[model samples]
Target: MTKLIIQIPCYNEEATLGMTLAELPRQIPGIDQVEWLIVNDGSSDRTVEVALANGVDHVVSFARNQGLAHAFMAGLEACLKAGADIIVNTDADNQYCAADIPRLVEPILQGEADIVVGARPIRQIKHFSPIKKLLQGFGSWVVRLASKTNVVDAPSGFRAISREAALRLNVFNEYTYTLETIIQAGRQGMAIKSVPIRTNGYLRPSRLVKSIPSYVKRSLLTILRISMTYKPLRFFAVLGSIPFSMGFLLGVRWLVLFFLENGTRSRAPSLILAAILILIGFQLWMFGLVADLMAVNRKVLEDIQLRLRRAELNSNQKER
Candidate 1:
């Protein structure tokens, strides 16, 4: 009897929370053994009341509204503390299907993966906005390139995390937790798998979508941050290569002009630009090497802690 905890994080989602809770038990027969956790992210509405009225197994409330990432972190910490063998995070807006929970966890149950995500197939949703789809595609590409893993859905909230993986995760206090978690899990050598699932359109407009530029900027910054942590060499190499390539091309043109026209300097501006670009590229490459060394040392320290934790777990299990 593996204990599973399903955590729903809500913020002013009273209108759909009841419906979402009602559909869960009906959709997932295994709900009989599962513990339901609803985190009221300081909703102005009756989100907490609805959870209690519906007889959810547990509820946690925040004093004030925190971002979605903070809400999720709190829920995850609660789930781990409750001795849940597996933790599933879903939205409170009823976007995700409870029926797909089993599919999401199947890989984890089979010992094939530590993290499983429910990937919403955008093609199935006729109402999905083109802008949302484009953003998702671009984000997915950035994650895949940075992590060097084929993860189709990096920002999906519907996910199952094994107990071990949950304990290992240390999400930063920011909206970037989604991408950060994926990268961190990869860095920890956790097996990650994705399952195709269908999600309904948002019942109401999401606050997240209101600021397109902000969202894009945050997402790109998160991606860059992850690249710096896990793939510093690649990050710096790409950064350096851009300027170096441009400078080389400019310098080649200058050389061509100078040789072809009786040793005359054709473009002094191009020469200066080329020199600046080349110097900056070299500096970037050196910075990358230093960052790579630091990353290696950090990984070594993390590995030592992991081994110690594993040993403690084994000793405790033997005593039990």
Candidate 2:
């Protein structure tokens, strides 16, 4: 039997929880069972109460606020435990059209992709400022380049993950799961696709991005960190080459002067600076090589982890 679970990670979302739950489809084609799961990330309000009142199948609660990324991962694990073959994660704010859940999961049901993201019309969203839209586009472009995937909405939280894909994902970001997961999917060679999705008007201001500047700073750091984590050699190699290239040019300048104007005419300071920069660049390159080796070890470990999870899932099925 195939099971599909729709999960919402919420905090202080009592106002919109009911509406979000009400829109969820009770049944979808190709799914034997459909269930709702909500992760209460230490909401002080009646978020949990609202979930239970609305007949949510599962409620995972944290005593303290753990942020959206943690809540998302926890919800995924809970759904897996509940025998979900496919899981759809959406926002509690009802920002996305819950009706799109079916379309979001269609790719997974059709075996076309391991993960499917709901791509909203960023430019059309009235709630978003022009800068926000531009940043979203640029950020998605950067993610596409880094992950080598064609995901049009890298920051979209509305996505579906297959059981196998869920097991392999390991998120390190506490701020957000949007970008890191896409990069992870791409690096792991999981098929990822996106379908056009429409968004409801904003009910409230965003809690995730407090300010534009702060959001940009944290987001850039998250992207850079994940890029390095998954592609250390490529990331570091590009960085190392800049200084190396400059040092090479400086050395050439000194050499040309020495040959043409005699040794006395050569700038000793220039030669010394070039040598230091070259050494620093060489060290950075070596670090990249070492990190690449470590990344290989990480991959081997991940493969073992995947096998272990598969075995555990099989054991659980037999027990049931």
Distance from true location, Cα of 66 in model 2, Å? 1.2
RMSD of 1: 3.4
Q: How does each model score on TM-score?
A: 0.85, 0.97
Every candidate's CA RMSD: 3.4, 1.1
lDDT of 2 at 193: 99
lDDT of 1: 0.81
lDDT score for residue 80 of model 1: 63
lDDT of 1 by residue, 169-202 (tens): 7766377467878887887678988899878666
Write model 2 residue lDDT over 101-182, tens digit each, in one string.
Answer: 8899999999999999999999889889999999889989989987899999898999999999999998899999999899
The global C-alpha lDDT for each of the candidates, from Candidate 1 onward, is 0.81, 0.92
TM-score of model number 1: 0.85
Per-model clash counts, in order, read: 0, 0
